[model samples]
Target: MARKHLVTHPSTAMMIRDTKAAEVAVLEHHERLDGSGYPRGLASADITPMGPILLLAEAFAYWDQLKVTLSPGTAKALADSAFAFADSCLLALQKALIDASPHTTPAPG
Candidate 1:
């Protein structure tokens, strides 16, 4: 899928003091934990922390906008589905981070 909106990354980064992080977040926000998302197909480990947050916010805004055109029940269902997908991706990303963390040895009592 050609995501034309991805071009906003550089423009957004140029306006922010934290250019790199902002750029990465914008670029990675569409990525999924299962590598099923667009532009890069990056997995959980590859995505930045802000990526998931942006994805969730975008999903909410999208569904919220659709509420105007869709029936209440349909809108609610779509919102729930979007939230579920975001939750699943977040959980997978959390798990990936946990798995990648270095184990620390406790001090002897």
Candidate 2:
């Protein structure tokens, strides 16, 4: 495929084949934790830690680009939805945000 051909980074290529951690995370970002994804129907435990983070980051970016602001509560609810996403990564991201913001109060979980 063009993707495989266009990638020139030896390290990245090796990561794609050998470990597949980064590849699965990025390439399979759209995949849910419940075996409801494309390219491959991978489920929880099958998905790596990075996958959830990458997927949430992508969602956040897209929402930002569209000027659609989600309240912390709404975002937290979506991330906490075990039926749709990975909770651990979302909680980590929320914690990071809370830690980074000096003035903003931490939202209740």
Candidate 3:
């Protein structure tokens, strides 16, 4: 509700709505691994384009959060442990697809 209220006008809403439309193609899956449906009831499919990836990123971030900087062994260890937790969340299957890349977009070539 609050999120909706934030963009209670046209310009912002149209952009968000259209972006979601484009995202539909990317998120155009529904069949939950446990058997579900689409739209307002989506699960696995919702996670396809960006949802699952978000989860993975958050998990890695959880690890990254353990330290202030990405330095030597400590940083790497935190990452490893965070990923280990992310792995556990996916129960191994989903872990393989996870990416450890930063959330920021890459610069142009």
For each candidate, what TM-score against the reference? 0.57, 0.54, 0.28
**Per-residue lDDT over 1-109 for candidate 3, one digit per residue giving the tens place of the 0 to 100 score:** 5224223333443566566643543342322322243334455434444434443454446654542233345434633542322224444323332343244578999
Worst 10-residue lDDT window for candidate 2 reads 2-11
Identify the candidate with maximal TM-score: 1
lDDT per residue as tens, model 2, 12-94: 64655555666556666656788776447678777776766777787666655555545578656786564366666656555
Across 25-78, the per-residue lDDT of candidate 1 in tens digits comes to: 888887777777767988867777788777766754554444323344544463
Global local distance difference test of model 3: 0.40
TM-score of 2: 0.54
Steric collisions counted per model: 0, 0, 0
List lDDT for all candidates, in order.
0.63, 0.61, 0.40
The candidate that achieves the highest lDDT relative to the unseen native structure: 1
Candidate 1 displacement at residue 50 in angstroms: 0.9
lDDT score, residue 88, model 1?
53
Q: What is the lDDT of residue 82 in candidate 2?
A: 46
Model 1 clash number:
0
